[model samples]
Target: MKSFLTILFFVAITAFSTDTVQSQTFPKMDTSPMDLAMARPDRNTPPIARVIYSRPQKNGREIFGELVPYGKVWRTGANEATELTIYEPLKVNETVLQPGTYTLYTIPEEDMWTVIINKNANVWGTVYKKENDIVRLETPARNAAAPAESLSMVFRPENNGATLMIGWDKTYVEVPFEKVK
Candidate 1:
């Protein structure tokens, strides 16, 4: 009985010690935390589309033409390449996008932004292959009403469809998605 008690005490100590070490070694919070945006007409309705991405702060730095350079493919937001999932068929720039998940990439310019929907998802950073592109559309960029400290994306309902509004710093762009006819 004494041996059994000794063994139990050692096991308890080992478990508590392991937990302490793990707590101390756990990774710190990411500088760019992941975020999610969904498209739905109302809060009670099911979402038509979803976007999972990371939000990186501006920190008073130039965003568009500098931090995210022009004429270069960007992952759209931050880490883990922006993921877009469509629950239904949608049309963008006259191209039909079937119901599936896709990676959203962008090429930002001074006045316009090229939105690319790639078949590849779950990619990290700016790993882009031209052959993997399913569709690309040009969207005009405009000045936002106010500066967005963090990169942000939201879906606004419009004309029985949805418009994805992306904003950072003082620049904003809109990508319209329509129901497939």
Candidate 2:
């Protein structure tokens, strides 16, 4: 009877261990990792703006106007909400946003896209609050030369500011922001 009890205990322990491992073994399926930063031309200055997001692949499927519909809030990327960290106060279009982290969201349209900076940095999927929006600016949407297999956000440095370029599939948009004096 003691041997039988020991065998049962070992079986239970193995089962629990297996369950724990399985729970933690979930894969990062999206795969496209993106990190973009805008820094001063001087080497001494640290990055003034940074963004981290997971990129989802096209996989031969329709993206803009279909997978991502128009006039709806998009999380801007896959997995955890796309995060933007600004170390200095900047003017996005005409709206001023203070230095802080924000979740980037967007509404895609054929002619234009509305880029949103939201106060909530910890959100998943398309869950967003309009009340939490810090600023929203509309930018022109244009066709890309070639289809981008994966989503991408790049920061193009300028003399006084930067342009945030977002591209996926065949569509792209640019948002300009400048440091506040």
Candidate 3:
């Protein structure tokens, strides 16, 4: 009888220990990306684009199209759209986002260029953000430039160093520094 009780006691202890150990779950952060195609190829190459960023980005206030402007399609992030790159899925301004990829487009002016996130993954380039899926988050665009017509999806690395620059014509707009992991 004593041995039986001892066995039962040990079983209970092991069960409790196993439950305690197994119950612990890793905490999850609220970062959900929309995960769309970051880049595509030229007409013949079938090129593939990769995702780039530092890690741990900031979510700030301001309507995307307001501070960011209205009209042009944006890359959604510093360079490309892959989930949170679209609207609601990932917070662009101070707004809470859902998580999804979007093609970003814009209409450039003196101050802002109406940053937009489109739903189209297969595009010729950062061309028509308006004609794609219109979901979005607006952020203020910054003034940065390269002399000639630079490719749109570029991340110039620096400190935490991540900048998504769109340069076509002499004019340019930048969505700076995204913390990526």
Candidate 4:
């Protein structure tokens, strides 16, 4: 009878542990589709940065107008949203940014675009309030070198830091913020 009880206890422990492990390893429900609503979706590769998201990129064909439409707040990628993150102090245009992470926001238009550096983080894309935003600046549209068939936010390598370039259609705009000492 003692041996029988010991066997039962072991079986119960193993089952409970297995259940716990399975729950922990269960696949996380995809939130990238909901994350990149405002930004144009990249067809080839999802535009959302991978490191920023805990899950695999939310990517699919026909995501732009069909899934993610124009003229909205984009999380910048999969996960909570694309955080306008910064580690060191940064200077956008004339404004000074202290050490902090911020939500990068944008207001798109036909001729030009309004890109903003908000103080708010941990927001679901633009779902949170915009009042916490520190600075909102507009960048003039730049002519694309060639027609880009994708919605891409490319950070071109620079000798110092790099230029953050946002491109869609034929019009593009750039914000060059150098790393501060």
Per-model clash counts, in order, read: 0, 0, 40, 2
List model 4 lDDT by residue over 1-181, tens digit each. 9999999999999999999988888577654333222111234632222113222232444433334455665554445655655545656776767766677766665556777777777776457467776776777767788855445565654544456776654657777665555
- RMSD each, Å: 3.1, 4.6, 17.3, 8.1
The models' CA-based lDDT, in order, is 0.92, 0.86, 0.44, 0.58
Q: Show pairs that collide, candidate 2.
A: none
Q: How accurate is candidate 2 locally (lDDT)?
A: 0.86
lDDT of 2 by residue, 1-181 (tens): 9999999999999999999999998677546565555545456877778888878889888998888888899998888889998888889978888888999999999999999999998778878999998889999999999989989888888888788889999999998879888
Predicted structure with the largest lDDT when compared to the true one:
1
Q: How displaced is residue 97 in candidate 1, in Å?
A: 0.6
- lDDT tens string, model 1, 1-181? 9999999999999999999988888688898899999999788988888999999999888888899999999998888999999999999888889999999999999999999999998999988998999889999999999999999999998767799998899999999999876
Model 3's C-alpha root-mean-square deviation from the true structure amounts to 17.3
Model 1 CA lDDT for position 120: 94
lDDT of 3 by residue, 1-181 (tens): 9999999999999999999988886677535222222432233633123333311122342333454345544443443342324221223333332345445555544555655555666454344545554534344445444433222345444343234555533445555433332
TM-score of each: 0.87, 0.80, 0.37, 0.55
User: Which candidate would rank higher by TM-score, 3 or 4?
Assistant: 4
